[model samples]
Target: MSDAISAASLLMAVVAILYGAWYQEIMHAIKITVPKHDKQINFMVVHNVLVSRCLPLTIMAAIVFLVFLPDVIEILQHALSVLGEMGVKSYRKYDSVRTAFCLVVFVSFIIAMHLCRLTRALMEVRRKLK
Candidate 1:
């Protein structure tokens, strides 16, 4: 199961990188004509750059999570068993670290999608202004 997760995570990371690259390339190809206040355009450009950079970090975090999941799970299982023996019911518990890591990865992916949408919206606004 850990191995499968690792593989899937790696695949996602690769896809994200490719998508980021393509998105940036397309954005660069377009000419901005939006009659926006300087601040808005600057903010938009900064946000685009930040999102692009975050893609790599997101990928790295996913890979790290996958690599550590097995060990983290083993530790959590042992802790749960010990607690269970002590009369503490080991309700369905998972490794907190693994769960948190996965959540971060998922959130990062969502943010990336949102960033893409925002970029598109900005481009559309720019086109309309021309």
Candidate 2:
């Protein structure tokens, strides 16, 4: 699982680099970067760039969650059992992993929803171009 995640991470890194190089073309096609900026930060452009850049990481995290869900569940059960016995002290044992898992799941969901919105926007742009 760790190997798979590592490989995915590497692949995402390469893809992100490539995407960074070519993203302006995509933005042009989707018209997201129109009304160009000049020494000023446009919130919408910033949001889109951030979203696009983070997409690779979010996708890798989501894939990790899907692939390791069973293991995560088993670990979570063990953590809970420890919690029951040791009360609050057990939190220290698994807090980082637990928190990371929760955060990945949450951020993945948000990114997925945002991707849906982006898809709709792309489709709209495509329609306009036609």
Candidate 3:
């Protein structure tokens, strides 16, 4: 399971880097120019910023979390068991890290859906242009 998590995180990091490079190349090829102060901002700037900077940072953080998750969970479980022994009610049956990980995956899926829509729209426009 830890290996799977590490692999997934590494895969995501690689994909993000590849996509960011592809996006930058496409943007450069198109010669897009958007005013920074424009009232209505387009996704190019936001996407570029996120892909170039935030995505790598987020991926690194997730990788770090994955690396330490086992130790954290073990410590947490031990604490909970000790508390339960002292007559304290403990809900150790739930795996919060797994739940959070699932949520992250789900949210990423939703974001990918949106990106797919955007990609489809771009393809349609390109097709019409040709």
Off by over 4 Å in 3: 26-91
TM-score of each: 0.37, 0.48, 0.43
lDDT of 3 by residue, 22-99 (tens): 565444423434444541344444445445544454455445455545655665577568677864454545556555
User: After superposition, which runs of candidate 2 have C-alpha atoms over 4 Å from their true positions?
Assistant: 1-5, 32-65, 95-113
Q: Can you write out model 2's per-residue Cα lDDT over 28-80, one digit (the tens) per residue? A: 54564434334133444444544564354445445644655565566678878
Q: What lDDT score goes with residue 130 in model 1?
A: 40
List of clashing residue pairs for candidate 1:
none
RMSD to the native, candidate 3?
10.6
Ranking by lDDT: 1, 2, 3
Pitting candidate 1 against candidate 2, the one with the higher lDDT is 1
Model 2: worst 10 consecutive residues (lDDT sum): 34-43
> Backbone clash tally for model 2?
0
TM-score ranking, best first: 2, 3, 1
Q: C-alpha displacement of 36 in model 1, angstroms? A: 16
Q: Which prediction has the highest TM-score against the true structure? A: 2
- Model 1 gets an lDDT of 0.54
Write down the RMSD of all candidates, one decimal each.
9.3, 8.2, 10.6
